[model samples]
Target: MPIPPVILAGIARMGMTPAALIWGGDTHQELLCGYIAAILMAFSSIASYLPQMKETGKLGFAAVFITAAGNIIISGQQYGIWAYGAYAKEGLFVDITGMLVGIGMMLGTILLAFVTFRAKVFPLWNVLLFVVMLVSFGVPGLESWFALFWGLAYGAMGFTIVSGKYRNKEAAAANSLNLAS
Candidate 1:
């Protein structure tokens, strides 16, 4: 409903569409564009996270690699170029790369949940809510529903996360109690 949620949904929908298109054998320039968009989204997310290291930690190489894999899949499909080299009929390497990226994304999400939980930085309920959204993005055969749910869930969760951080800051200023710096 709000801007952040809309962005979150867009990211999930973008991610889901490429996989669906490839699985349906509908590789096209559109897929390539979506892949690029996904990477841009990842980068933007990473950049925005720079100042909020405590709230959203730094993006790791694995995150970059996973996002790159999505870009490669779409680019390969659109232009017939494989990152590893000439495409073989078997496509073993490409498939493996994609699956690995997917796994990385899943694990990264779990890590997010763990970090937020351990820090007690956000409401427990909201943390659970975000996890549900993250999971929906990867659930198979429910692309549209997943996108919708994730978009709304993460959008709300993101706002809550940021708001909680702000509240912590305010609380610290008021109490003169140094938070975990």
Candidate 2:
């Protein structure tokens, strides 16, 4: 999520458009970072969903799946761009696909967050913060800042999960066992 904007900042510093940046042959690191971020997002989405699942049940499960699918698509797209920059240049399909996936991912994330919020599994403040940061994506002047805040919001939720701040220890333990097997 944050990777693209950071890369865009680098592109701006270099006075290059996004397409030009993709064609520059020096975007390996940026592409790799974006791919890794997508993978991490997928895993974290699953991790956070574990607690919410206890309260939200199958709705939480569905939301996480949607979020995971979006991330997987994003990672695959990044891989394609890294492997075949020429194909990206041939048409608007690549760009359009990226934009659509981004929108879908954003909506999926919002739904998951809302579901979690209703579950009351995580702290209300944290969940609200996460939702607000995500909503900022649509604000024109805050687009760049959203990346940073969204990362912080997501990181806070990750920290909450890791710190065992959720309400149900038994469910979490059982879920961990189920995940392992």
- In terms of TM-score, which candidate is strongest? 2
RMSD of each: 6.9, 7.1
The global C-alpha lDDT for each of the candidates, from Candidate 1 onward, is: 0.47, 0.65
Instruction: Residues 1-181, candidate 1: write the lDDT tens digits.
Output: 4445325534554454445555533334334444444544454433222223454434433343444444445334434432322453247776786676567656655565555555453456745765776777777866545534433444444565445453244432332233334
Indicate the worst ten consecutive residues by lDDT in candidate 1.
171-180
The estimated TM-scores of all candidates read 0.52, 0.70
Cα displacement (Å) at residue 79, model 1: 8.4
Deviation in Å, model 1, residue 114 alpha carbon: 1.8
For model 2, the stretches where C-alpha displacement exceeds 4 angstroms are: 1-29, 82-92, 167-181
| Candidate 2 weakest lDDT stretch, 10 residues | 10-19
Query: After best superposition, candidate 2 residue 101: deviation in angstroms?
Result: 1.2
